[model samples]
Each structure stands twice: as C-alpha cells, then as structure tokens.
Target: MRRLRIEGYVIVSADGRLANVDNLMPDELKFEGDKKFFSAALDQADLILHGRNSYEDQPSSPKRNRIILTRKVGTIAPDPSNPKATLWNPAGASFEAACDHAGIGSGTVAVIGGPGVFGMFMDRYDTFWLSLAPRVRLPDGEPCFPGVPARSPQDVLAAHGLKPGEVQMLDPEEDISVTPFRRAAS
Candidate 1:
C-alpha cells in the first residue's frame, strides 16, 4: 500500500486571519518570500487539493494534478476551466479515490485552502507550513481555520498532535515567519 502524506500550506496574519472581510486575500497581506515558499512546495507535490473557492482563484497550472473539493455530489468531472483539475466531492469519493482519479499513486499531497478545506484535513496533516506576518493584523478577516474554537493556529495544530518546529524568518524587514509543525512521533 502506498502511504500518502497530506501537508497543509497556509499564510495567515498575526491575528490568524487568512483573508479580509471581503473573503479576498489582500495585496498587503501577501509576501514574496511566502509566495515563493508555497509555490515551490506545490511544484514538488504529486497532488494538490483545494476548496472550490481557492481553486477558482488560482491560475491554471497544467503540470500539476489538482482536486477541487466541493459539497455537491455527482459532479466528479474534469474541470472545464483547467484541464489538469477535477471537481471532487469528498462525501461521495474518498481521498484515496480522488488521488487515484488524479493519477497520483504516492508522495506528498498539498492541501491549500479556504478554512473549511483546511479544517477537513486537519487530522491527516503530516506537516503544516504556517507562514505569518507578525506585523500584519486583519481585524475583520476570515480565520485560518473557520469555526475552530482554538484561540490561535498553534493551539489548533497542537490539538491535532502536531508539535511546532523551528521558526524560519521569511522576511526580516516585514517580520514574516514560517513555522513547520510536524506530527509527533509515536
């Protein structure tokens, strides 16, 4: 059996917001270093899973196999907008099945998301790359994990048995940092 590792990638503000009030990621909230890190990670993944909203916002990348998670069943089909993408409903198809549908047999699977998508795979994440801009705070923004009662992203990851690793400074001037939390060894 091929063991598939699911990894989550997210960029949040100091306040744990993933997006602004409009449900859109603002320019000020974006950092070049974080973008490069995430893009490189995705480039190396065998499969990428995203929520419908995030999938729609992403530019088409034919080289990467992607699955867009949706709630509407019976809509499992190739995405019309992106040839390398598929619309999948987890309720009808398992994650393994979705990977098979995308022709991914093994290796890392990147889960890039909206809050629900991130929350859905919380328990399965082998590692979560959480990048944050300490100086940035979105008072009225969407959280990294919606409806999660945890006060902070760290608390949420800790609740899932992930232990925080060393923090890497992505942008010193901007005070942006990336932290990797790996599942504790059994």
Candidate 2:
C-alpha cells in the first residue's frame, strides 16, 4: 500500500480569504518562523504531489522531485523551461503508483493542495500536517481547501479515524497553530 500525506496551511477566518489559491506560501506572513517549519517538512518528503494550480504557483526548481496531477495522459516530464518538476498525467499507473515509482516508499509523500487533490485522497492520506497562524490576518483570498462539506478538522478526522499528536506550539509571540495528525490503526 502507498502512503499518502495531506499537509497545508489554512486560515480559519469568516471569509476564508487567508488561504488563497494564488499564494504558494500562505505561511509566509512577514516572519521566518513558519518558513522554517515548512522547509523542515519539505525536507522529509522525497517526492511532492500537488494539483496543477499549486504546481503553477511554485517557482521552478530542481531541489526536490515534484509530481503535478492533471487529466491529460502520457505527460511525465516537467516543463521544459524548468526541468526540475515532473508532470504526471493519469496514465497506465495511477498517481499513487507514480509516487511509488518516484521512491516515496517509506518517506513522507506530501500532498500540497489545490482543494480537489486534497479531497480526492483525504481518506487515503496517512498523515495530515497543518499549520495554524494565529496573529496574521487576511481579509480576502480563496480558501485553503474547497468543495468538501463544511466541517471542522476534528470532525473530519473522527470520520476518517485519525487522531492528533501532542500539541507543539512554534511561537508564543505569533500565536501560531501547529497541528499534526496520523491515521489510527484499524
């Protein structure tokens, strides 16, 4: 069985503007603190899977193996302009199989969001790494994850049989939210 991980930052505001689809790095709120945590998490994963929108939002680089999921088939290479990232259209093997091929066996295979991608594999995702920024505020932007029936993370986790780990606060000054989850053993 392939391991799936869902991880992203979402702003819990009334308007849901803080978690914009346009912004690649929502945790970058004029502080290096959040960036540090994200960077650390990114390092744990050998491969990164993201939706087309999230992939396009990122600056092309060769630092890590990237998989962009889309509908088209026979597409496996990253953009010619940026050779670092790889594109994976639904082909002979499913996206999960492609991640296994990319050598994500035991290491973390992070599913960065575009909403649909997260929703598609929410049940299959083994771990959920979430960061809650406490102080900074965004009044206008798209949501972090969309299209799922409105429910608290706790509620969703209970439905999926996931449990939270011991709470670890990053910065008391920032009042940030740092949450992590893992699937409970069946």
Candidate 3:
C-alpha cells in the first residue's frame, strides 16, 4: 500500500554479499558498466532512500533529494547536513506520509542499499535490480539482503513475491550480469 512505486537496486558478490565484513564495498566488485546502469536508474528516480551509512557523502549528493532511514529520529526531521535530505523513521511514519513531508508526491523511489534499509522494503519493491559479479567471492561478508549467504538472494526475492526476468550482461570481461525482478501480479 504505498501510493508511490518503490524500486530497489543493489550489486552483490557471487556469494551474495553486499560488502565485506567491514561494511565496505570492495574495489574488486566495482565495474564501470554496472556503475553506469545504477547511476542512470537513480538519475531517473523522484526520490532516493537509503540508510545513513550508505550515503556516499559525494559533492553531488546534497543536491539529490533523499530520505535517510534512521531510528534516532522519532518521525521525520530535516537532515542537518543536506538541504534536500530528510531523516525518517519508518516505524513512526508511513512511506507516503514521509514522501509527502519531503514534498515528493507520486513517482519512482529508488531504494538504495545497506541490509536493514533494503530488507525494510522487501514486500514493497515494484522492481529490484540485482547485479551480480559472478567471479567475485566474499565469504563471511555482510549479506546483500537478510537470509543471504545461508539462503540464496534469489530465494529471498522469490519468497517476497518477486520473479526474475532475463539477465543482461553488463560487463562480459568482468562477468557481471544484471537481473531485474518484478513483483508478481495478484
């Protein structure tokens, strides 16, 4: 029941890790082609949602409209660091209300990563773009989603009612492929 559409985007390792144990995305996993696709997708979104740690702190981030998921806030608060960002607690306010408070009415919301933020939108994602680096392996690393390393990322998505579409190779030399999973129709 959100009025606005939600799409999740993430790139995982062969073993289904989003980042290494230290919560740092390894350089080996970054591919130019995959980055291009991810960037383009976010560029089209009306709003971007992600947790505090996931914020890149890039110079351009302040200009991008975003919601920073956090428990420190009781409900909704303007992010002190970024003029266009809002600190939101999902438990305190509904997604729509949060968007309304942020001045974004109806449009695509790109939900970016870090496990907790990604897992919170499991049942709500209209589409989840999963790009995998098949040759990269990071054992005992942070999972891309909940139940990941123990259970495959595909299993988690299927359980949440999302089905994968055709895989497109983003980088053949890097052996990276991206799959867009859509929620099944009722």
Candidate 4:
C-alpha cells in the first residue's frame, strides 16, 4: 500500500477545542523561525499537496513536484517553469490514488492545507508532521484545523490506527517547534 502522510499545524485547546481555519493564518504567523523550517520541509518533500487557498502561498521556485487539489481548477498543462506541477481533482477515490495517478507514487507526500483538506484525509493519513508556534497568537485570525469536534492528536491517532512517533525541537537556534507522528507498526 502507498504511504500517505498528513503534515501540518493546527491550534487546539488543552481539552481539545480546535481553532478554525478562518482564524488560523494571519500576520502573526510571519515568524522567521517557522518560515525557515517550513521551507526546509518543503524542499524535502517529494511532492507537495495543497488545497486552493494554501496553493496561493506556494513559492515561485519549487524544488519538488507540486500537486494541487481543486474542484474548479483544471489541468494546467506542464510548462518549462512548472514541468512537475499539476492540479488534481480527487473526484472520489482516495487522494492517494489521485497522487499516484499524478505520478506522485513514492517518497513523502506533504499535505499542506486548508482545514477541509486535512479533515478529508485525516483518517487515511499514515503520518503527521506538526509545527507548533507557541509564541505567535492570532487574536482574530483563522485557525489551523477546523470543523468536527476537536480532539487531541493522541485521540485522533487512536481513532485512525496511528501512533505517536517523535516530538522534536526543530531549529533550536530559531526556537521553531515541531513533532512527528507515525502510524503504529503493524
């Protein structure tokens, strides 16, 4: 089976109340530290998966294949500048199949997103890489993961047959925080 990974950040309460997407991204997220790590991770991804709104933030010079999911956007035939970038519409079957059909068959599939995308693949994801910017607080911006009842990462993992992997302090110099969770070994 293909290895599917969901990697991104979300804000939640200690008891499990998650912030909504409409309040997630804001001027406060402009941390140089978080930016560095995010860029680094993007470089490491074999293919970057993103929703419509998230795709708008894509860097001009991407080092890996970029697979954008959208119901409205049609195929943007490959160009010299975007030889590996393509927009996919996951009509129904697993997004994994969409990725496969788009030639994103192996390596890490980074699911960078808007909340709906995350929620759609949450249960099927094999791993999750999360970044926590404990310092930046958005008073009225959008939330990270929205909709559905909020649940701690642990609870969500258990429900999806996933398990905690390792929590690391990324970019100690910049104080960027991150954690990685993998599906329980079978």
Report how far residue 21 has shifted in candidate 1, in Å.
Answer: 0.5
Q: Residue 87 CA error for candidate 2 (Å)? A: 1.2
Worst lDDT window (10 residues) for model 3?
55-64
For candidate 2, lDDT tens digit of each residue in 1-186? Answer: 544554543323333333544554455443455556666666666677777776423232357777777766474545454445556776545766666546555556667766666656667667676556645455545555553236554456556666787766666677755666677766
TM-score versus the correct structure, for each prediction? 0.92, 0.73, 0.94, 0.70
RMSD each, Å: 1.9, 3.9, 1.7, 4.3
Instruction: Specify the highest-lDDT model's number.
Output: 3
List model 1 lDDT by residue over 5-121, tens digit each.
899999898889888889888887788888878888888888889987784233435678899998765747677787888789877878778788778789999998989999988
**Model 2 misplaced stretches (Cα beyond 4 Å):** 1-18, 21-31, 55-61, 72-78, 90-93, 100-106, 135-140, 147-149
Count backbone overlaps in model 3.
0
CA-lDDT, candidates in order: 0.84, 0.58, 0.88, 0.58
Candidate 4 lDDT over residue span 138-168, tens digit each: 4433444443235454566456666666667
Ordered from best to worst TM-score, the candidate numbers read 3, 1, 2, 4
* Model 3 lDDT, residue 162, Cα: 95
Question: Model 3, range 10-47, lDDT digits (tens) per residue?
Answer: 99998999888788888978898898888878778889
What is residue 11's positional error in candidate 2, in angstroms? 6.5
Cα deviation at 183, candidate 1, in Å, is 0.4
Ranking by lDDT: 3, 1, 4, 2
User: What are the clash counts of all predictions, listed in order?
Assistant: 0, 2, 0, 7
